[model samples]
Structure formats: C-alpha cells, structure tokens
Target: MTGNARSEETLLLRSAVDRLKTALPRTWTLDLDLDPGRDGTVTAVAPDARLTIRTPSGASATFTIEVKRASRGSVRGALERLLLLSDGQPALVITDFANPALRKQCEELGIGYVDLTGWVFIRNDSAGIFVRTQGPARQAPLPDGRTTATKRLDGPGASKVVRALWDVTSTTGVRELAQRAGVSAGTVTKVLPALAAYGAVTRLRDGGVTDVDRRLLMERWTLDYKIYRTNPEVLWRLAPRGPDLAYADLLATDLGNDPTGRTIAYTGWLAATVSLPEGNYPVVPNTLLSIYSADPGALGDDLGLRTASPQTANVVLIRPRDETLLTGVPLPVPEPQIIADLMTMGGRYDELATQLSEATSVRTETP
Candidate 1:
C-alpha cells in the first residue's frame, strides 16, 4: 500500500472505533482499548486497534482487529493476515466500505468484521453482535490537504473505467483501456488515482490497471455521490403545451445530438421506469423529466420549459458530473448513478431508489 493508502486505512480505523462507541447497545458496554502500549501494534506489525465489549451481566471479550486499506478481494487471505498477528485470538476485519458478501464469509468462518457502511458482524463464544446502519455518505475522501478539490469518480470517464474493470474480465493498459471505454486517455489517468485513493484499483508494474474491486468501487462511489458530489442540477417544470415525450424528445435530440456540447444523459421517473427495464420499478406517469445537461436552458427553450412550481413541476434538469455518464447506458445517468441520485430524492423516489439499488447491486453492467 502507498502512504496515502495507509493513511486512508488509519483514518477508517479511527472512524470504526468511533462508530463502535456509538453503535453499542445501551445495555452493553464497549471500550476502545487504545492504551499507549496496546495501540494494536503487535510485534513489528500490530492490528488496527484492540476492542473490548461487555454485556451488563458481566460477559466480556477483547478483540484485536486488522483494518485493511480495503479487502484484498479474498476473504480467506484477510482472515489469515489478521490471525497471523493476533496469536490465535479472534480477528475482526474492517475496510473503508462494507461488503455483505465478505461479511457473510466472516460469519461463516467465525471471524468478525465491519465495513464503514454500517454493516457489522461479530461473534465469539461469549457474545455476538450484528447490526447494520447507514454507512458514511461522503462523496470522496476529505481533501488530502495537498489539493484544494477532492478527487471525483462520478463522471462518465469514471463510469467507463469502472465498468470496464467490472464487466470485462481482461486487463488493459491506460491508453488501451481508454480507447476501449470510449473516454480520453487523460480521463483514464485522472480516474485511476482517485479509485486507488480508496483501494479500489491496483496498478500493474507497468502502471496499468491489473485488478479492481468493482463492488468496493461502486460502494465508495455511492457514499460520495450521495453525500458530497455537487448537484449542479436546476430542477424546473413546465406544463407541456403538448405531450411530455414531445418535450423530452426535443431535449434528448438537442443534447444527445449536439456535436459540440457536453455529453449528457437522463434520469428520473421516466428514464428509470420506461427507458431502463432493469429497475422494474413502478413510477407515476410522466411525473417529471430529469436530464444530464450542461446547457438545459438551450434544450429546454425548444420545448417551452418554464419555471415550474416545486409542487407542480413536470421536469427536473440536472447538471451532470461528466461525459462518462452518457457512454454506456440509454439513460443519461447510468444505473448506479441513477440509483444514488434517486436515493437522495427521498419519497416515492426513495421506493424507486431501493428497487434500483437492489437491481444494480446484482448486475451493474448495462444490458
């Protein structure tokens, strides 16, 4: 792991301990055993921290945990690494984000672990605790202090890179991968490091991408997109003078066919419910239209879009993160992006969000 990677893991360690303090049941007591001598440094290599949990009736167990920068794509290997330094004591594995699949392995093998996203599983002969809370929803790692802006991985370039890594089972160089993903080489250069910051991508000796934790990548992406990514979208509605599709087609044709405009996409009830069938979600008819556009006014003007009252709006115009969103999917925002965006809407959209999330969780690749 690189220095930044190590720092990221250490930060996650502190966060996990803090969450442990708050996540404990009122009837149970948990102590963060961060004593000076036992700061989880075992021999030359110590675990992240030592934790002790006690129930009111007096049962208690101490666990020294190993917090990885991220799960290294192998649950057994992670379990082994923790046990090696733990001297046979139970090992708890944690990552920057949780993997339910990994959590299942931990439970089956009697190992304990938690992902930053509120998924926790711990079991010992004396006590067992299982809880799932909403995970951290930050958009990206807090700026590393060296740069003014945080790394962003929500755009189309990122989608291309991430999808290639997730769907294509072969390895490719930066330039080749860029060609394959229909994105610029500069964009590939930009996205790889951002993914690496969270241990989502591993570079080859040739500085090419060799491995990617697609699930972890998406999980972290959602956390940041839901929490921090700027929504430059300016939502407005117009009572259509004609049919809703008439206006939608106008905007889609204008933006999608623009030879010299930003790459755009669409998401909202119509895109998710009608254009994309993966979500299988029921939506109100023509309730609203959302598009990924840098120049919505230009497109909206053709369709006679006007300022819609929040209560009576028939369309939503979103500012897109980047061009990568338009590459692979029929909708402006792809599945993961749409799912995360919908999650933030909170209402009937929330129901659709859940459906989209479940669908995307199983098959992230576009049909």
Candidate 2:
C-alpha cells in the first residue's frame, strides 16, 4: 500500500476505535503504539480489556499506549515511525492535552488530531472540530496528592449506586442518577455518608452529588464486590431464590455445613409480611438474631439494631461470635439525596451489563 493509503487506513482505524470505545464504555483497554513493522502492512492492535475484538481480515492491530509523561517530541517521533511502518498511510494522533507539543506538530503537518480533554474528545476534521464525550473517568485523589485510577464501577447494587452519583456529579449533574439507581431516596441518603468518608462521592449544597474521587471508590468497591461475586456461599445467600428453595433455607444449610458447625450456636427464623396493599408477603430473616450461652450483654446493644421492628419484613439474621472482627468507626448515615445518587449508578450498571452481553454475543458470532 502507498504511504497515503496506509495513513488513511490508520485514520479510519483510529476513528473506528474511538467510536467503539464510546459505544462500549469501560469494556475495553486502549493502547497506542509506534514501532517498525514487517512486510508492507502497518499493524494496529485494539484489545478489549475484558474480551478481544477480532478483525475480519485475520489481522490484529498492534497495541500501544502513549504515556502521560511522554514528551511531545517522543510522541511525534513515535507517530512518525508508526506512519512509516504503515508505508505512508495517513494516521490520526489521538492523545490528551498533556501532549501539547505533539498536538502542535500534528496541527503544523495538517494531520488530524483528537484532543481527549475534559473527558471528551475534540476531533478536528476538514470542516471544524467535532466534540464527543465518553463516560466519565473513575478516579479518586490519594492522600499523597496523586490520582488513583481504576475501572468504572459496574458492580453490585450498593456500588452501582455510588458510581452513578460520581458520574452525575463529574458530568455537571445533567444526568438523572436517582431514577437510574432504582433505589429509594431515603436509602441513598443513608449510604452517602459512608461513600463520602472514602472520598467516593462529593455532595453539593443544592442537594446534588458528584464523584470527586472515583479511583478510591473503585479500589474499595473492587475488593468488596469480589467477595460477594466470587464466594458461592455469599452469592447463594444473597440470591433471590435458588433451585426452588428460599434464600433463608440456603443460608441455614450453609451455616450447618460450616467448619465451625455446632461449636458456634445458631438460632433464627425466617419471617414474611407485606408492606404494600397489593404485593405478596416477602420473606425476611431477622439478621439481628443473637447466639450466646451466657449473658449476651452490651455486645448485643452495640450491634446497632435500634431501628429493628417486627413489622419490617426484609431483615437478615446475623451474629458476631468474635466482635473484634467487626471493629470500625461508624460512618454517618447518608441523607436522602445519597440514595438518589446510588440509583443512578445501579442504572448505569444495568445498562453496561446489557451492552457487554450484546458485545460478547456479537464477537462470538462474528467470523
């Protein structure tokens, strides 16, 4: 292929990758590379972080990522090498404002350049600049004044809620997060304090919430989500229903089979009642059930079950044999707005899950 042809191909590939990333949101890993190539073809590699995007032509592009601290001259040199490897095909340089010098070089060369600033890309085409915004970055600032980064929160219910608030806040609250999270306004409020303490969310005085620190939330939630997602026992217990049996039964079976067994006494009953006029009664396990041979004393009081009532139907039974394992400073319960924020996150997770499933299916069906 001629130099111009290769550049055009690279440009096309760059545009395609950008579109894919926008459409798939946090489902892929992007790397930009520049190096010498074999034969006449310049290779470009685009790998989805979680899955692979296979090319129809049986050729995969080489993957490269331009580091933030790499100098403009270095990036320009790399781009030049990549263009040469492409046999003179026109290539678009996609980078952030961090590489001002390289961007300036691209402008001088009249080559196309995409600026990823403010979480949106400024595409300079023949006519003018076109703007495209992707999902917000999930990040939090470290105590050492550096930023921590991770995947966007697409986890369980509580985490999804927290991330939705972060995305809404980061994007100027144009997004309706509460409706998306599917959580009660009251519940969101209750969770906000815990999220705020971890710097996962920022609350605006006008009843708005934002994610001032997404990285922190990602790191913490990653651990928490894995525990729930990977543990068969935990997941089974949390599941709505398994094998026609109620979740309470499953929990009981699990407890019975536990290594500690009868050494750790267990006593609880599953309860069910209705909250709405038309809805059927939902089973609730009294998570506050106690187990003790002698006096359960101050330990029971410290368990923070003051809000418990017989009428509440969604309770889960829990007991702490070793209270030392539960030590932590209690976070203040969030206000109603926090619940609204979490609802937004839940919606995002649902949307992302749908998209990922579709993408996986498409990839599998493609030749």
Summed backbone clashes in each candidate are: 10, 38
Task: In angstroms, give how far residue 244 of model 1 lies from its true place.
Answer: 3.2
How many clashing pairs does model 1 include?
A: 10
- Which residue segments of model 1 deviate by more than 4 Å? 1-67, 71-76, 80-89, 94-109, 114-122, 127-150, 154-160, 163-166, 169-176, 182-216, 226-235, 241-245, 248-265, 274-285, 319-337, 353-367
User: What digit string (tens of lDDT, one per residue) describes model 1 on residues 1-367?
Assistant: 5988667777887787666667777788777654424444447665666777888778878887777544244445667777776777767776765544455566776777766557666777755545545553432344455521135655656666666655444566888888877788888777766565455666664657766665556665655554124555565767565336754466555556666574457776655575345436465445666666666667566566777766777776666655456543234555655655665654577677666555655554545
Lowest-sum lDDT 10-residue window in model 2: 268-277
lDDT tens readout by residue for model 2, 52-83: 22233332333222222111224445556545
Summed over model 2, clashes come to: 38
Worst 10 residues of 1 by lDDT: 141-150
How does each model score on lDDT?
0.61, 0.35
Task: Give TM per candidate.
Answer: 0.60, 0.23
